[model samples]
Target: MLLDTFGRQAVDLRVSLTDRCNLRCTYCMPEEGLQWLGRSELLTDEEIVRLVSIAVTDLGVTEVRFTGGEPLLRPGLVAIVAACAELAPRPELSLTSNGIGLARIAAALKAAGLDRVNVSLDTLDPEVFRTLTRRSRHQDVLDGLAAAEAAGLTPVKLNAVLMRGVNDHEAPDLLAWCLAHGYQLRFIEQMPLDAQHGWDRSQMVTAGEILERLGTRFALTPEPSAARGAAPAERWLVDGGPASVGVIASVTRPFCRACDRTRLTADGQVRNCLFATGETDLRTALREGGSDAEIAALWRAAMWGKKAGAGIDDPEFLQPERPMSAIGG
Candidate 1:
């Protein structure tokens, strides 16, 4: 295993397929267009494949998750997943999407060997959903869920960012709906990753509070299926249903001690911590004709320098300068 300075293994890479997305969520990106990477500046399919091979064979990486502004928007996504599926050790490959175009492409994605998907959804109210996502189609996302289910993508994960007044009340209904749909619902604590203002604890609903709310209707319990202690969420059986609810307390309860993921931005920067001050720019070196060995060396150096934790709730912690879209949320 390729262990970092803090002895965190580089077993997972959240490779972003693209930095362009259709929606403009309240917490994700500013509505104003930001300068995107030019076509020539982005990593080629071959380069991406080579990197994945390096991560698997050279670093013993066991997971490669595809994330993005909306990963499904990437033209080369299916091909990339196919290449990842061909790895020797067969790292667990997954995708996180906004589900805007999923209904149209879910089947093709499944055929390309994507193991599972985490769909971002904030509210069940169509108008509120539109307000939250700016210009997204709630119906299309709903269809995307249906299509994913029909395509045999079992345990489709729903990622709901729990904002204080925005959609916190949607929690109970959202969990109940996912239970009926056989989907896993995970409530993420709203971190001020790229927020307009620095993250405020007042805007957050803590995991303890969430569980307290859940206990009213459902008999909540911890999960045996949690990955030792890596799972930030405490799982629960909801109201005699087969479905379960999870809470990822990233902002309120930080998961720094057991953090196991690294990120590769769309522009090819390597980020040890999402909230780190800056990234090691592998893209510039790659575009400048640096050798694969040299690029790998940089990757290794950055990994070893991983930050202690992404302090989302820390008062002194400055918000990342880069937009969430640019950094591949």
Candidate 2:
């Protein structure tokens, strides 16, 4: 098991298929975008499957989520999902994407064993979407959501980040749209994970503010604390029951104490925490003929050294150098 000194065992694995993304969201990167990982630096399909198999069969990872600059952009995504689904314990599979090419591949992904998907969508308005993503593919995203639902990606989740003056006012409307469309909406607090390193706390929409804005149109009932478990989102029963919304307050209500996730970069580096300043390289070891036991031991050691928390509230907190895009969401 990937256990830390704080007694947190990692049961969830987030693997970055590629560091390349199609859309350049303002919160993620610059309009021109940062340098992407070279083809040689990225793990091959076999390497990714082997590492994921090790995590599931040996390291006790019960859930596997594939992320990237945009995972849908990967050519071998469907095959990768199929391979992982064939594992002995058969870990639950999912993907986090920008929803650009999802419409064309949603059915293929569902048939390939992807259980669900979480798409990044900040606004329902096409113009606002373009402004936030710096891309005019708002219609593509909407079509992707519809395709995902049609393909049976049940409880299709939407991850929305509210910038101070940009799309922060759409909190209620976004939630309302999700409720009407039978989609699960999760509002995430923008953290210091941008490539530009220009994240300002004052400009961010806090979890409290999000709830306050949402409260204007909807009556939300908080789910019991015991029901949250190690999940990042704190869910609330919308209105009365059945429908619900979630808030992933990574900056405000940090859930590091209950975190069960371990991350693998597109290049095969182990990231114990999303805000970690350092990484453990498994690619070098894998390429150097390291045995499965040796690789597993390396992963175990990496998780054992995980920090207690992200420390976003600390006076001297430093944003990660890789940014959200490189870090796989």
Candidate 3:
């Protein structure tokens, strides 16, 4: 297995299929949604498959994740999932989505070989959900989750950004709801990906704080799952059933030293660090008639250049200027 500068072995990759999205989550995207990437500039399905093949075979990446401004917005998402699943070794393939249009395509996704789904749902209250995501149909997210479960994506995951004063109070209630429904709920700390999107350091909630809150209500015990890559989330199983929770400590606590994953943007740029300004333009390489081996060399440079840590966790470190939409989350 190929390991990056940090001790992390390269096992997982999150590929952003499109820069376009259906919902304008105020935190990730501007209210007026940013400009979408031109069709000609995005990575072709063949190019994406080649890159993933190199990653899995050459770099020993064991898992590939499909993401985007909302990965479901991409037209050939199911095909992309199918292609990734066809990898000889068959690394774990999954997709993360906002779930706006998930109800229509959940079954097709399962049929296409998507192993799991992570739906972004922040609030239970409709009005508050509208305020956070700036979208109606708060229940649509729940419906999407139900559809995914019915389509055999059992124990569907729900990813919630635990912002202070917004949905922190609902942590216990959210856990209870997930327990009843048998969904794995993960709470992520809001990173400083977009400085202008009203991200306040004071409003941030850390993983330690989240564990404390859960411990107050349930007998939360830490699990010994392999910390394979840049996934900062330390997981725990709640007292009773198969339900569990994960804490992604992006801020207040950083996992820079053990960071492993690499991200490919919809526009075909390899971003080693989410907060880094530098990007190797693979679209240029592809367009300039670069061969597969040539493009693979450039990818190697990008991997070797992965930064120490995302600047969000350290107050002394300068934060990333790029918004979350431009970079895969």
Best by lDDT: 2
Q: How would you encode candidate 1's per-residue C-alpha lDDT over 8-76 as one tens digit per residue? A: 776778888788889888777677755677988678877777777877877778888888878888888
- How badly does each model clash, as a count of residue pairs? 0, 0, 0
Q: Looking at candidate 2, what is the lDDT of residue 63?
A: 98
Q: After superposition, how far is residue 296 of candidate 3 from its true place, in Å?
A: 1.4
6-80, model 2: which lDDT tens digit per residue?
Answer: 999999999999888888888889999889999999999999999999999999999999999789888999999
List where candidate 2 sits over 4 angstroms from the true fold: none
Global fold similarity of model 2 (TM-score): 0.99
Q: Report lDDT (CA) for all predictions.
A: 0.79, 0.94, 0.80
Error in Å for residue 315 of model 1: 3.8
What's the TM-score of each model vs. the native?
Answer: 0.93, 0.99, 0.92
Cα lDDT tens digits, model 3, 1-329, are 54556655657787988877777776677788887779888898888887888778777788888988788888888888888888889888888888888899999999988888999988788888888888797877888898999998755888988777777777887888887888888998887776265677787887878888888899886776564245677788789535568888777667778767788898888888777778888878888888867877888877776767677645576655557776787
For model 1, the superposed segments whose C-alpha errors exceed 4 Å read 224-228, 239-242
For model 3, the stretches where C-alpha displacement exceeds 4 angstroms are: 195-197, 225-230, 240-242, 313-316
